[model samples]
Target: MQPLDKSVYGPFQLYYDHALEMWCKDPANAGKQMSLHSVPQMVSYAFQKAFTPAKILPGFKSTGIYPMDRNIFPDHKFMPTYSADRPAPIPNRDEPASDSDSERRHTATTSPAPSKLDTFTSLKEIRPFPKAPARTEGPKKRKAVMSAILTSTPEKLSSQTVTISAAGPSKPKKLHYDADDDEGSQQCSGKTFGWNK
Candidate 1:
């Protein structure tokens, strides 16, 4: 393998590359490299070798390879064997029990008795809530406002003061009343005397 660049993550990069090679060589052993039991030791080794924190590794971040799980090796006991014909051990029924069992039994027995509510057939029905009293302020206040609006007088139009003068009296023609009145009165008397004679 080419020598890793001596950068901040150089050692971690080398270890990661070695781990990857090991993983590629045997995928089954990959679990062992990352198992819970071996991760701390593996991380310690990596730290001593000057590897950067595992979380910052390109492969670890991209592949989500946790340091702990990566180092953990699976226990062989947990694997299932199809050919092994081993029967599971049966539970023992004759084991001595404690007072809690007796209490549990008593509670179970008493709990099954029918309650008074079990025999009840009918329940009092709930009545709908009465509508809230109509708002008193609404109609009364509306009528008062309407009446006040109807009775009020419209505002008067504004007036302005203008200066005006009285017109001069018309001149009258002088009547010749003295001559006309004397002549008319004499003619009326003459006519009245002739009619009477």
Candidate 2:
């Protein structure tokens, strides 16, 4: 192994190196090196500057939880951030999770997370996720979102279906199939192709 060059990190490295070189050359302490505390502090002081805070975060003065001097990120940087309790599923709020589901979830949550040691060599080494079944008609078309101001009166449960509409509500529009209106617009006066009025 080769020794690191003191001036490798540009002018800042050279600047730090110059100070150390001066200290080492000082006749008062010719043999002694800087202490652990002093060395780390010196290194940090050389690199760490005033513009360290990450976020502006309106109304909040401090950028982070702790002060700049207080070492929030210690020597051992990253701690495992996996949650002990997994978050609830965001989908299907209308239907509550059953007891069986809760039990399954509990078992799933209790399973130990794949450790850092779990390494794979090839595609065949790892378990594969189930592939989705193929559909013949390609992808389905997206439906429009329903209007907010719609008021539905279920005449018959089968007849009354929520149609996705962008307009403010379903108005009582008279079916005009064959005749033309006063404004010369072809208003087709005929029955709508549905089960109800």
Candidate 3:
């Protein structure tokens, strides 16, 4: 029998009705009409079978709810991404234009004549940045820096420097081997061979 409590029966009425329909329409029961007396029993049996605990256990495990493991979902689930690189759709060029739209197109195509500001030549006058002060100070400082770097010499380098170590100046090492040295000569002649003494 359907539960008398709306809280219990209200949510289940749709499922119960569906199961009753299936049961009543079964091929085995075809041509045999089910009386009102048999509907509640059939609906109750079908609903119980549909929601059995055995059938629902796997669902809970797949969703990682029973043991609460978050890694059950596969890595590829986070890999799909939206791409903005696709080619834009082709626009329809054969549209039937209305009077207003054609007027707008004509107006947009034939632009107004250039003003005095637009026709003015940029080369005639320098338009320095409004935020910058008179560039006189900057050029003077830059000129001084350039002159100092270009004219710098060893004397200038030594003026600001202090000698840490006065180890007498070192000479570059000379090459040990010359073209006159024989290729077959022993590098250490004092070490004699076993029988060559």
Strongest candidate by lDDT: 3
Better of 2 and 3 by lDDT: 3
TM-scores for every predicted model: 0.17, 0.19, 0.24
Q: What is the lDDT of residue 43 in candidate 1?
A: 57
Position 125, candidate 3: lDDT: 62
Clash counts for all predictions: 12, 7, 0
Each candidate's lDDT (Cα)?
Answer: 0.50, 0.51, 0.59
RMSD of 2: 31.3
Candidate 1, 182: how far from true, in Å? 99
Over the full model, what C-alpha lDDT does candidate 2 score relative to the true structure? 0.51
lDDT of 1 by residue, 21-52 (tens): 65547856754645576556555666666644
Clashes of 3: 0
**Candidate order by lDDT, highest to lowest?**
3, 2, 1
User: Order of candidates by TM-score, top first?
Assistant: 3, 2, 1
Candidate 1: list runs displaced more than 4 Å: 1-6, 23-33, 51-197
Which prediction has more favorable lDDT, 1 or 3? 3
Which is the better candidate, 1 or 2, if ranked by TM-score? 2
Q: What is the per-residue lDDT of model 3 for residues 17-116, given as tens digits with 9 covering 90 to 100?
A: 7777887678988888778888778668656755655555655665677677789778876654566456657888898889998999899889866665
| Residue 97, model 3: Cα distance from true site in angstroms | 38
